[model samples]
Structures are given as C-alpha cells and as structure tokens.
Target: MDISIREGILTPDTFAGLRAACGMPELETALVGRAIESSLFTLSAVNGSRTVGMVRVVGDGAFVFLIYDLLVVPLWRRRGIGSRLVEEAVSRAKLFVPPGRAVVVSLFSAEGREGFYSRLGFTELPAAGLGAGMQCFYL
Candidate 1:
C-alpha cells in the first residue's frame, strides 16, 4: 500500500522476478541488465524493499520514446501502481523535449490491456491517422 516510485534502480533479478510474477517469459540476466541500463529512463514501484512494478522508456530522446516493459506483480495490480508508473514515465519523457516542441510516448500494450492504457491517455495505433504499430521478435 505504501509504494514509492524510484528511477533506474532495478537489478536484473528484480526485473526478472516481476516478470515471472506477472507470467511473462524470463530473459537472461545479462541481457536484462543491459536493457535496464540502456533504458532512456526507468521507473520502478517499490513497496518497502520489494519491487512491485516497473516501466522503461526507450528510443531517441528527440523523436520517440517507447514505454517498454511495464509490469506490475499480480498482487499489486489495479491498485494504481501501474498507472503511477506509466504517468511518471510519461512525465519523464516530456522532460526530454524542448519548449514548444513535442515528442511521442509509445507503448505496445499487452492484449486485453489496451483499455488500461487508453484510460491513461494513450490512443490505439491506426487511430489519429497513424498506421498501426508493428513488431517482430527473435528468440
């Protein structure tokens, strides 16, 4: 219930733990470390010493910012922790742009989670005259 949002302090283990807790596939710790460190910005939700959720921002600071790897442990879902992580991540992304300029903050929402993000001000792709976003994965 007492959650604090912190910046860039996630260990690979903590990240992988949250992923597993949320039923996402695990990644190699080395790769997870690289991803965490290379993130343009990251916010983690900590309740006491445990990491309950996280969101990472990736992409060039000028043109695009992708809200990647947003995960909240099942125990903490629907308690506003995810929303706070996203709101904080987007707030940080806005800081990267200059006055009178704009930048995009994008994310690939999990299936059935679109409504959660839409309520937080994200429009689905292919709306607003933009083509639908696409992705491919390599194992």
Candidate 2:
C-alpha cells in the first residue's frame, strides 16, 4: 500500500473518523479541533486521500513531548504505517529544541501494546528510577 505521512494536515473530522474506525469512543469534534490546534505537532498517514492513521504530539517543546492519539485503521495495522508515524513524529519532536538539549517523549500505549512501544525504544515506566505513569481524568 502506498502511504504518505503528511505533517500538520489533520482535520477534526478526520480525527473523529479514525477514532471510530479504531473502536475508540466518540469525541466531540469541537473539542477535538481545540486539541488539535493546541498540539505542538500532528501527522496524518494518508493512502490516496484517505487518512488511515494519525498522531498528535503535545507538550512544552523543551521539556516534554506526549505522543497522543496514535492510531491506524484496522485495515492498515501491522503494515509498518503506525511505526513510521511514530518514528517520524519523534524525529520531529527532537528538532523542537536546540542541540544538546534533551526532551522526554511519552505516550500512554493502548492495552497490550506495551511491547510495541518498547521495541520502538520506549522504556517501560517504573524502570531505572522512573516511577509508573499516572493520570487523573475529570468528570
């Protein structure tokens, strides 16, 4: 399959569609648009005008980068499209800061997908002095 990774081209509707295709719960498109606008970077994986996958990176450019909403439609999974999206996003994240500065790239992987991120050079939390990741969702 011919897939092209486009930078900063994600639309809220496209994002909602991808989420639905991946079996994730629906989100309000207005909220999604706001989130997309706030992202430091966004990438869309397109196969002939259809968005098959996408990722959003958010955080202060110098200190942290969160890889959010990494998704590839079911039909495109395991074909390296997801991996390429992540690698490319991280590569761009690294450039956000000046030389010799380090930034933490973090992501909350989907259930059972820890090994995927691990193989991509992400260390499991609570290892090597890092604590397990935590989160708090609002009502």
Candidate 3:
C-alpha cells in the first residue's frame, strides 16, 4: 500500500473528517476545529484521497513538544499507518531540536494505551515520588 503523510492545512472540512476518524465518543468537533486552526503542526495520512489518520503537534516549537490527537480510523488500525505518522513527526522534531539543549517530548497515554506508545519508543518517566508534582488544570 502506498501511504503518503503530509503536512495538511487544517480547515473546517478537513477537521471534521479527521475528528470523525478519531472514533472517540466524547470528542467535540468545535474544540477540534479550534485546535486544528491554532495548533503548530497538523499531519494527515492519505491513502489516495481518503485521510485515514491524523495527529496534531502542539508545543513551543523549541524545547517542549507535545503530541496530541493521534487518531487512526478503525479500518486503518494495525496497518502501520499510525506508526508512520508518529515516526514522521518525530523526525521533523529532531531536525529542530538543538544539540544538547533542554528538549522534552511528552505525551499522555490513557490506560492500556501505554503498549502502543511503548512500541513507538516511548516509556514512562520514573516516578521517584519527589518533585514539584505533575499538575494539570481541567474544568
């Protein structure tokens, strides 16, 4: 199968289609639209004219990079499309990450999702039970 991964400009139509591919019951199209328009990097995996998968990268574009919204349609799962998408994104980041600078690439994986990320070369940062603490503000 010929798969093309490209940096796609996010629009209302593209965003809606990508959101649908996510297969998440609770995802909001409005928020996704807002994010796609505002995020730093958005990627689309195209098999012919169909967008099979999508992922969003949000970060300072310097030191801290966060991977978000890595979604692959059910039909495309286990087909290596998602892995290629992640690989392409990581490759792009490597180009910009300064040598020896304090660069951090982070992602949050839900329970049972760790294995997926692990297969992609991600591992949990050790929990030393010491630090400023992991903090998140959600409404």
Span of ten consecutive residues with least summed lDDT in model 2: 96-105
lDDT tens per residue, model 2, 27-133? 98789999999999899999997999999999988888999999999999999999999999989998998877876799998889999999999998889889999
TM-score for candidate 1, please give it.
Answer: 0.94
* Candidate 1 residue-wise lDDT, 4-48, digit = tens: 999989889999899899988989989999998888988999999
Query: Any idea what lDDT model 3 has?
Result: 0.75
Q: Which stretches of model 3 miss by more than 4 angstroms?
A: 26-30, 99-103, 127-137
TM-score of 2: 0.96
lDDT tens digits, residue span 1-139, model 3: 7778988655556667666656555457687678777776888888898787887888888877788878788888888988998888777776667776655667777668878888888766554653332668999
lDDT of each: 0.91, 0.93, 0.75
Candidate 2 scores a C-alpha RMSD against the true structure in Å of 0.9
What is the TM-score (0 to 1) of candidate 3? 0.80
Question: Could you list the CA RMSD of all candidates, in the order they appear?
Answer: 1.3, 0.9, 2.9
